[model samples]
Target: MVDVKKTSTTSQNVLRAHYKTLRPPNALRGNEVIILRHAETIAEVFPDWIERCKLDTTQLYPFDLNMPVRIPQRPNMKEAYMHDPPLSEVGRIMTQIFARELVVRNAIPRQIYSSPSLASIQTALDIKNFIGNQCGAICVDESLSSNRHDSKYWLTEKDMTRLRYCIGEFCVELQTEKSSLNDIVQDMKNLVATLVQKKKQHYVVLIVTDSLAAQILYDALSGIQSSYNEPLQQLYRKAERTFPPVSSTVFTPSTRNGILVMEPSRNSLRPLTRIGETTRPDFDSEEYVDAKP
Candidate 1:
């Protein structure tokens, strides 16, 4: 039998490791606004805690990370995969749960803009449901998805072997594409500028994207100024992104508004199914399109 104490210790370690980006010594000020990825069902373990706080769901923005990526390897399949796939049922539920948590936390926004993707649109719908339909929501730019690419590479067997050999290196490359990373940072700057210009304090934006995009944004939020720096570098003294159990450390700003850090309750190591794997029906396949739910 597993030792309960050992397991608990391990779980805490895992949580700490996975969400290292939340580690503090942050530069947050009270009046400055904050933004985060969309709320997810994974945070349901502390349902009571969520109930206490309410989000400003009205101004919530769902930034889609699912922009098309061009992996330039095969002439036979020249086009890149559809990066902005629809949300899986699990993703949808998680999103709704996240929305509820935000509403409870009183972190909703007054104006919102999302990536022009169906999944983001759906998330916008949920936020509207939570905070009422009076808030502003729109898909302002396709670039918000950070979908910029003109080249590609195929992970052949040899490359896969090399990736396995040095998972950290490959994972870094996979996460840190120069073009896409820059685009995302620019998008974030735009969003922040809009908030500041509008003088909209006490508002929050929720961005939704793949883990890679999330990690990238999380790094930026933690004050990473350049994409050239390795993500795994600061995490572990001797670890890299390819290391099997990569976790981020997050630090909250020292604002009177109070900052909370939460994650999925379960410590299961199962792989998150890509949106295409579920009922979304090849949403990533790029072969067809849904009628826009």
Candidate 2:
């Protein structure tokens, strides 16, 4: 088992500090969706897996349950892992930490939806077990999996440089026409609508997916419509480079709610307020800390 204590203490401290300030967007009291990328995967981040890959590049990467392996790139160090990898020990620890934090803050979701990938499913299950009754059922949804989308290939250092340049160029295009909503985006929107339209008015739904799907959902819910607008040839050119590692993004209905993007080291929730709008004073200032209910 990967020792959670070995992980950076800075991240844990940051989570502890900011967790005191997290609040359910008043506008989304009953309806809100939080999208998160799955924790690290065994095939991708485990030191043991890395050593194994180094020892036998020709052999198939092993899986806990003989899961598939999808290599999109040149089978580079980063992309050479099982297709449906399970969470690494570090990932399991992180999930437990996050779940415990949510429970302490009284911010546990009522419903959890995970991508079909083994890593996501494992993360969701860990969280469900940790939070107990504070969280509800876990559903696996294909729409949230990156497998449904085109492959994103990452190559050597030179290729990564080119990919970054492409992402910079694409960000500029975002200022113009919004990219047409694709089938995946539509499916995600439909899922959110279905959740929100339920008889219960207050529902907090958590979606655990790949970085690409998480980005798309963030763009959709925040009304940014920037990142996912490009065509396949242009979009996903550098999907991995777009977002920071292990980030959690929250989306609520009201403009006043703004968008909260949290990462492991960031001490405060970064708010992206809508144009010409200001967030509530309580939310705007971190000075006021509310007692956990």
TM-scores of the candidates are 0.40, 0.54
Candidate 2: tens digits of C-alpha lDDT, residues 207-256:
88876777666555544434355565444433444432244655554323
Q: Against the true structure, candidate 2 has what lDDT?
A: 0.52
The sequence of per-residue lDDT tens digits that candidate 1 reaches over residues 1-293 is: 98999998888877553545654232222222323233232122223221232212222122223211211232333122133233434545655554554454444545544443334444555555656654434333333444434224223335434423211112112222545455556765555445444443444444433233444444344443444344532422222221111121222333224543222212111222344431111112221122121
> What's the residue-level lDDT of 56 in candidate 2?
41
Candidate 2, backbone clash total: 4
Give the lDDT of residue 128 in candidate 2.
85
The best candidate by TM-score is: 2
Model 1: per-residue Cα lDDT at residue 199: 41
Each candidate's number of clashing pairs is: 40, 4
Best by lDDT: 2
